[model samples]
Target: MQQISINTPALLFPAITLLMLAYTNRFLALATLIRNLHTKYKQGQEDRNLLRQQIKNLRRRLLLIKQMQASGITSFFCCVLCMLFFYIGYEGWAYGIFGLSLGFLLLSLVLSLNEIYISTKALEIELKDME
Candidate 1:
């Protein structure tokens, strides 16, 4: 097995940061969409069934995004902790923490993929409504 080092975990820092930024952008865009939907629903500008379906989809997507962010943040934290452990000469602990960090990052990516699938499904729903 390749020996773990502080640099190994540090490499994830930039990638994780970028992922978090992307996730935050996704969240902000979703929030804007939700607000727009709310306004349209309030003004009765859209069909009730379509709006309700969209709202349901948005709720699920929102929850998924929240989970993705949490897992990503946890991964980032674990990476930092891993580095700290290595710096302090706890090679064993550092290796374990690094593994955990990778696991969390994998989970976050999976959640992001699921959210993307759901997002596309939502778009399909809208298109179907139009048809």
Candidate 2:
């Protein structure tokens, strides 16, 4: 059996890393916004500012959630394609593709979870303000 080339797997590592970075970036941004909201809530009396921030956060997070879900779905399909390559490429490029796709799948799932958590938190905060 011919050995698979390292290049095959190597190509995937960077793509997966980029996806992970994207997920982390979104999470960091959300955290920052939440912290800012907390600061505004404690330091001043302008409820409007806090409310506006919350609303904006919620809107952005909702968009992020949708994007995460879509990315997750796409990653899954890529994984399937990778598996197919394993057979088609006979444990060479296919295996490499599989590894890359798997990483993408994991990253997408993590992003999806992050988006969902942020969205739920936003919804919870909104509910707390109901009059």
Candidate 3:
């Protein structure tokens, strides 16, 4: 294996930071939606079954976002560790850690995509009511 410079893993720092920011935004938006739904439910404005279905969708999406955040954080930590191992002259370990970081980042992205899909389904539910 080619010896990698510490800078190699350091390149992921910005990308991971941006990904985490996006995930946080998604979480915040979901929280606001849940709060509004709770208020509406309390006011007895929306149909019970519709509200229940939306809540279920939100629950799944929240779980996906949590998993995404966890995976992204793990990736970020692994990237830092990869850099540390490279600086200490452990080329093989650095390579392995870098691989793990990439894998985790991939997992995070997959989870994010799944969450987006579920979010769209929620929107569709709302649209159906409008029709």
CA displacement after TM-score superposition, residue 114 of candidate 1 (Å): 0.2
Give residue 25's error in model 1 in angstroms: 0.5
Model 2 C-alpha lDDT per residue in residues 1-103, reported as the tens digit of each score: 5465535444554565576576667667777867777677678744785578686866778577557646655665565566566656666566665656666
User: What's the lDDT for residue 49 in model 3?
Assistant: 87
What are the models' TM-scores? 0.98, 0.50, 0.97
User: Whole-model Cα lDDT per candidate?
Assistant: 0.95, 0.64, 0.95
State residue 131's C-alpha deviation in candidate 3, in Å.
0.7
The segments of candidate 3 whose C-alpha lies over 4 angstroms from its true place after superposition are: none
Q: Candidate 2, residue 15: CA error in Å?
A: 22
TM-score of 3: 0.97
Clashes of each: 0, 1, 0
Between prediction 1 and prediction 2, the one with superior lDDT is 1
Lowest summed lDDT window (length 10), candidate 1: 1-10
Q: Which residue pairs show collisions in model 3?
A: none
Best by TM-score: 1
Local distance difference test, candidate 1: 0.95
